[model samples]
Target: MSDALEKAEAAVREASTDTAAVQLAFAAMELAKAAQQQAQTVPQHHQCEHQHKPRRSAGEWLGIACAVCVGGVGIAFASLALAILGGTAAIVVLVLRSMWTDYQRKGR
Candidate 1:
């Protein structure tokens, strides 16, 4: 009976140790699967394949050109007024026109 009990105890200990090892192996497999999934899901940066789109249509260009001509005339009148008023208004008008030209060039 004592020998039989010892054998049963040894068997239980072996089985418990085997269960622990199997659990650890399962955990390691889960970690490896997670790492593989993460590797597969990683995003890579690639060059953009998009093209530039123009902001204005043909009709828009015509309208913008007309507006610029009108604005130039208005600025000329304002400059004349500034000249008569005897202040820096003429300089301001010139600066504004310069900025407008720069803006138009950049838009193109």
Candidate 2:
């Protein structure tokens, strides 16, 4: 019997006027006792058992390294393309501005 169940039983005995209250208290005490017994019978354990994954093999590691290298090369190419595009745009803008200024001066 748990400490809480014992206390409740003692309290119920002291004030056992209401028959319904006494019955409810007795039912609760019984449940507590049943749970206590179940706990003792069953083994304690963590809620979640940790499952460890197997370590990567040499072949898997080599494949992963190759994938990383390919990804890095792709990123480098993309950056280089963007830089070229920006430089071309700047040159075009400067050339157009100069042509417009020369045309205006000739007109004046």
Candidate 3:
């Protein structure tokens, strides 16, 4: 019974050693293959070619001009409204400046 036990223990140790050696061999082969592939690959360079587009149509330009005119009128009306509210634009500016200063002082 003791002899059988000793044989089983030796067999287990031999199998473990064989498995470790096989793993090391496979790892070495994989490393060599990777190195070979890295050495063989070459990088590529490319140049970009950009194309220019034509200008907008007259209708499109007119639309943009109209939009700008509308924005200007809106700004004018807003200024007028602010003036009528306090009888002067300076009052609105002073109020805005004071609010900003207070906000800054509060770290908000």
Tens-digit lDDT track of model 3 for 40-90: 774444434577688899999999999999999999999989769876667
Each prediction's RMSD over C-alphas, in Å, is 23.4, 14.6, 20.7
| Model 2 lDDT at residue 46 | 37
Quantify how close model 1 is to the true structure by its C-alpha RMSD in Å: 23.4
Q: How do the predictions measure up, each by TM-score?
A: 0.41, 0.51, 0.39
Q: In model 2, what is the error at residue 68, expressed in angstroms?
A: 0.7
Model 1 C-alpha lDDT per residue in residues 71-99, reported as the tens digit of each score? 99999999998788766767789899999
Give a tens-digit lDDT track for model 2, residues 29-93. 99999999987887667346888899999999999999999999999999999999999999999
Give me the runs in candidate 1 sitting further than 4 Å from their true place: 46-108
lDDT of 3: 0.91
Candidates sorted by lDDT, best first: 2, 1, 3
lDDT of 1 at 91: 74
User: What alpha-carbon RMSD in Å does predicted model 2 have with respect to the real structure?
Assistant: 14.6
Give candidate 2 misplaced runs (Cα > 4 Å).
1-49
Q: Candidates' lDDT values, in order?
A: 0.92, 0.93, 0.91
Model 2 C-alpha lDDT versus the unseen true structure: 0.93
Error of 3 at 4 (Å): 0.7
Q: Rank by TM-score, highest first.
A: 2, 1, 3
- Candidate 3 segments whose C-alpha is farther than 4 A from its true place: 43-108
